[model samples]
Target: MALSLKLRQGLVSFFLLLLLLPSSFVAIEQAFYTQLLTNAEQKLEVHLYAILSELSMREDKIELTNNALAPDFYRPDSGISAYINDEQRLLWQSDSSLNQQFELPNVELIPGQHLFHLVSQQQNFWVLSIALLFDAGEQTFPLTIHIVQAEQMLLLPHQSFKRTLLQWFIGIGIGLLALSLLAYYWTTAPLTRLDQEIRKLEQGKQEQLNLSYPSELKVIKEDLNLLLANQNRQKQRYRNHLSDLAHALKTPIAVLNTSALSQQPELKEQLDRITAMIEHQLKRASSSGQDIWKKELPVRPLLDKLTGALHKIYRDKACPISIDCPEHIQFRGDETDLMEILGNLLDNACKACQHQVKLTVTDKPFCLIVEDDGPGIAEHKRQQLFNRGTRLDTYKEGHGVGLSIVAELVSSYSATITISDSPLGGARFTLQFPLEQ
Candidate 1:
């Protein structure tokens, strides 16, 4: 459900491209169209001046003294036309306009004034018009010169530029995408390597982070290695203290056992209880519970060894222990913790079953199920079965502390143990371990 850093970066880049590329393309296209209009207006203004210079007055009417203008004025349908008007009357028109039906712009202008804009009719055109005063025998005449060019002329160049611009932008977008992908990989390479190293450490393939890393990650690497060293030292010291305590208590206990008071029935029982409590506490303390890092060990080999030993110990019953563990199934904790859990569960199943016992290992939830074919535990009594001194059977073999130890060990690893009715007609002890992933 959570997104990785690389994927987040890639998504940001993708959305930026989606927003920026089209905006850039539109901005560039609009700018190019404006430039085309400016160029078109300038060209029309030049033709207007050329036509104004060639005009003359004849019989008090405007006329062209000479056809000295751009060749577009002389060529028909050339998309460029010129006209001269006097007070709403057409004085003269260009040869190019003879076959075209373009109406001149109706605009009021004074002498020395000019106007340039676009006009829409059946088709669009750019118009440039200027007003001028003509002199003839002391009479002044106001005349307007008009020059118009079809919008198609500018559109041809505009569309061509758009196609060219689109191609360039598309190429640019693709190149940028490729570079972003390469940058994503380049930036995350160190993180990928560090992740692999951590996984190897978890699997007990490596003891500490040994790979060379960037400055940002080097501090973390050093801190982790130091923590591992400190934990090792602390565990060693704790074990040494427990060993010393055990040895110190051993002498007093031996002397008591040799005394006459310890031989009394009640005193002997009390002494035996004290000895069992000591053994239980020491075993519980020795467990490497819920360590930060854990090793992965295959379950099949250990299961074979436990089942073999249980068979020899309970040879009188000769109850079959059916193991349903895959060869690759693994336990992700201390080997001693796994052995203690499975050993106690299997041994109890063998003792409780009349004929059959079963042990199954599963990976999905990382659970161990031990079942037997004997009288099932009562629901009311099951809740108290794990108490330190609660024994359900009269077999006189165990101190009734195994399940309690199992509960403490399971709780340390953040695991759960449940007792339920088994299909085999006896109690099912289900030990589910926490999955690392």
Candidate 2:
């Protein structure tokens, strides 16, 4: 169960990280690229203004001198070009590659700051055009100076920034995986130990769990310890009750046994019957009381002792009793309780058979089957067998409390008792217990 909980937590964490990491990385990368583009655009606009100012001062020369100060003036990789024109006629071009025809409306040509399109070999360039107007007497000359730069130069830094961002993302992902493993171990270790401690308690080891934990878990540990202490107290109280009940019943049973053996035959017979009934009731009470908190008991030795006692009690009767049980089979029940159940069952089976009786006990899944070779009970009569004092024959010299006691004991433990035909041509009683791991 602890492993299942840890696995569930890890899966949830992994998916959460998967969703958050990408979003965080993209937001950071986009913010960085936006700032880089803004800076690049501002620098480009300043450089274009400076170049346009230089050209405006040289507009008087009909063919501008090639020595106009800027270096690499006509290089394709320079990322800058310029053109000069006046009144629908090109007077001078700074670079022939920059002289391509542009479709611009007349409104876009202003005397100060203006933006216009410049076509260069099928690619469009952004041109900042400024017209210089000089008035000598009554004539005004409109000299348009265009500064052109390719847009690709503005996007170069963004690509480089994205490449660096991808590298950082890979590194962070690996680190997070390593951190997740470390966190899983650190968090789950105490829980694993607690689970093992609980299993030990279930197996009757009865040791206190000692864990070094954080404040959040300290409360849980205290609660578990309190629960364990309460359970131990309850078990001890049950044991004390059984001992007291047994001691209380002992003297009365002794008096009854003594009175049953007195000299008057008729009175002795009546007292003997009452004494047997009292003894049966006492034994049933004692067994039931102890079983209130009984644990698992080894089966073979108890069965051997019980069958041996039965064999000796019926030794004078001319009968053969067979016993078959595995030497190592164990059952979850009280020893005294099972002894009573088996004693009553076998005693009744022996009386019903004339010359042969057989007893067998076998362990099965969640149950035990006890069978005897005797006259099997009829279907209709079996139901009545569980009622107190309901004997099938009045001539039988015993109180009919045996099967009833068995029924009561079985019911107390929430076990089932079923009567069926045995393979030995006799009765079978299958007692089904709750499954234990």
Candidate 3:
């Protein structure tokens, strides 16, 4: 199954934590081990000086004041031991070294220096040694002190510390991951609701979008609601138009049925008219102008191709049709709807013009105005320009049908259409559309 956004984000956050935290903990453990080793060396160095203080110089040989030493040095199997050696004899060894054969790696050191090394016998061991020069009036003496302890004596406590730290880190990592998942789901709860509502819409369980959403999703909700409203409006318009078209065709069919001899041409004319009406209504019904998710279509090229076709149709008039549109400007609607609207408007303007037809497109307010230099319509007649299938210019065939379709297209896109007198001394039609974002 596909993962939802919330689950995907949570998994990513958890994996990142898992990857980074272990390396961080391992670094911290290494630092702690270094500090622990330093402390262990200091403890062993103290025992070396204790052995030095108890030594006595004699002409015959070097001697310790007594056999008694630190407790661990005497305790059997304590893992701690000391040794004292003269130039030519095995002078002494700690009681703790009773069953071992380990020795210091270095025999001598500089007068003021002590040295530490690791050696192996029964186990890995730490051996610390020092050389001190004693002077009498007539002779000199050299003695070496050695302290040896098993490495495990120092490492055992560090191992326990590591186990404790690992436990704590694992616990913290799991806790943090849980908290992250909780927050992720909480923050995305509204999105889940929105998704459910959309599915409900697709299944026709709901008439419209009605869920209350957070601000982050509020704009999207509003847009979806607008889309649903537009779809319903288009359906209603199609139903009303179909009913009216049927009523209209009934009269023409009745006229043809009643007429008989020497009325064949009249009957043929009525049939052609009925056919035209049916074709027009079918074309309008099929155009899906309620597409709210449509992308912007570039307007310049559509206008360009349209004006070219009109020029050919009205070639005898040779009307100078000028276009003032930006090459990169776009219209936010279905491309076919725009073509229908613009095509009808421009063709009407071309029909009415005597000498000039001009199209001006503006970006700031996102509108296009088409004006022609012909006899303009009076102001009173302009008010009824968009009524369904009502021809104010009865002299021109199909005038009402084109303008009604343009009005419907405009309504579907939340646009406005207005008629006014033009500066060119003719009628002007302006289509103002919503701004592109």
Candidate 4:
């Protein structure tokens, strides 16, 4: 449900790309269109000055001294037109204005003053105007020269530029996104390798980190290797101390067995109890308890070995032992710990059952169920069964300790053991180990 580092980074990159690209495109397009408008106004101003240079006044009638101009000005519907006005009465006009009908803008201007802005009639247009004073016989007449160009003229090039700009921006966005993906992968590749190595270590496929790593990870690798070495040394030293203690106690117990204390049944019984307690405690303490790294071991083979030995021990009873387990099902823990748990459970089932015993293994949480056909245990007495040295005197000599040992081993691995009625009309002992510990 949680996202990975690589996926999170990639999502952020794509989100930024989506957000920034459109904003950048709109800003650039608006700037370009503004520049086009400014250029169009400047061109119209040039046309206005050209018309002023050729104007002349004769007998209060406006005329052109030289009627020379650009070819567009001489053609009708050319989208560019010029007009000369004196006090709102048209004095002169370009040939381009003969067919186009447009209302002139009202204005009050001082001589030598110029104005430029946009106007919208049926369509948009740019209008530029300049005011001048014309000299006649002892009088001055105010004249205004105007230039009007249609909006369609500028839109043609603007649209073309928009298309070209869109293509270029799209290409640039794609290139940047590709580079972002590459950078993401390149930066996370080392982490991927480190993850793989850690998985191998957990599965017991490798004892320590073996691959070369970046400097940041190298210190972690060395620390892990040192921890593993220290664990090995501690386990070895612990086993040695338990072995030495057991040997030291055995000698005194042997010597007492040969002395006069052996003649008294009470002393002999106490010595036997002490011996049993020592053995039980040592076994409990030496268990390879919950470990961080464990090997995957097949359950079927271990079950087979335990069942074989149980059959030999209970050959006289001839009880049928049924094992229900898949070949591929594995137990992830110490092999010896597994053997101890299964061996004791199956042995107790064989001893309790009158004619049948069954063992079932499940995969999801690594469970084991051992059942028998004898009378099932009463609910009231079930809790006391896990207590040390708690058993009926009618059972075999070693029966008191088997279930207690099972309880200790199961607890060490953080597993649960429950006693319930079995379908076979006997007791069921179910042990469930967590998949992840």
Best by TM-score: 1
Give the lDDT of residue 431 in candidate 1. 84
TM-score pick, better of 2 and 3: 3
Return the TM-score for each candidate structure: 0.74, 0.53, 0.54, 0.67
Candidate 3 per-residue lDDT, tens place, 166-247, comes to: 9999898888888877877788788888878776665456867698989988998898888888877886788778778778
- State the number of backbone clashes in model 2: 0
**RMSD to native for every prediction?**
4.8, 8.9, 14.4, 5.9
TM-score head-to-head 1 vs 2, winner: 1
Per-residue lDDT of model 2, residues 1-437, tens digit only? 67789889889879977988899889988898677656644654575555554543333554432354355456645766666677877666555344444443243466765554444545555566667674534566787766666555545666787788889988998899789878988888877777777666544465566767667667887987887677567766765776676677677666765773564777666666666666666556555433322344567788778778877878887566676767766666566778877778778777666666766666654455666666778989988999877887544567677788888877766778989998877778787766541
Error of 4 at 327 (Å): 5.9
lDDT of 4 at 68: 64
For model 2, what is the alpha-carbon lDDT of residue 87?
81
Candidate no. 1 TM-score: 0.74
Q: lDDT of each structure?
A: 0.86, 0.67, 0.78, 0.85
**Per-residue lDDT over 276-381 for candidate 1, one digit per residue giving the tens place of the 0 to 100 score:** 8998899799788757667677789999999999999999998999989989887777888888988888888888899999999999768889999989899999
Angstrom error at residue 58, model 3: 3.8
Output the number of the lDDT-best candidate.
1
Q: Write the number of the candidate with greater lDDT, choosing between 2 and 3.
A: 3
Candidate order by TM-score, highest to lowest? 1, 4, 3, 2
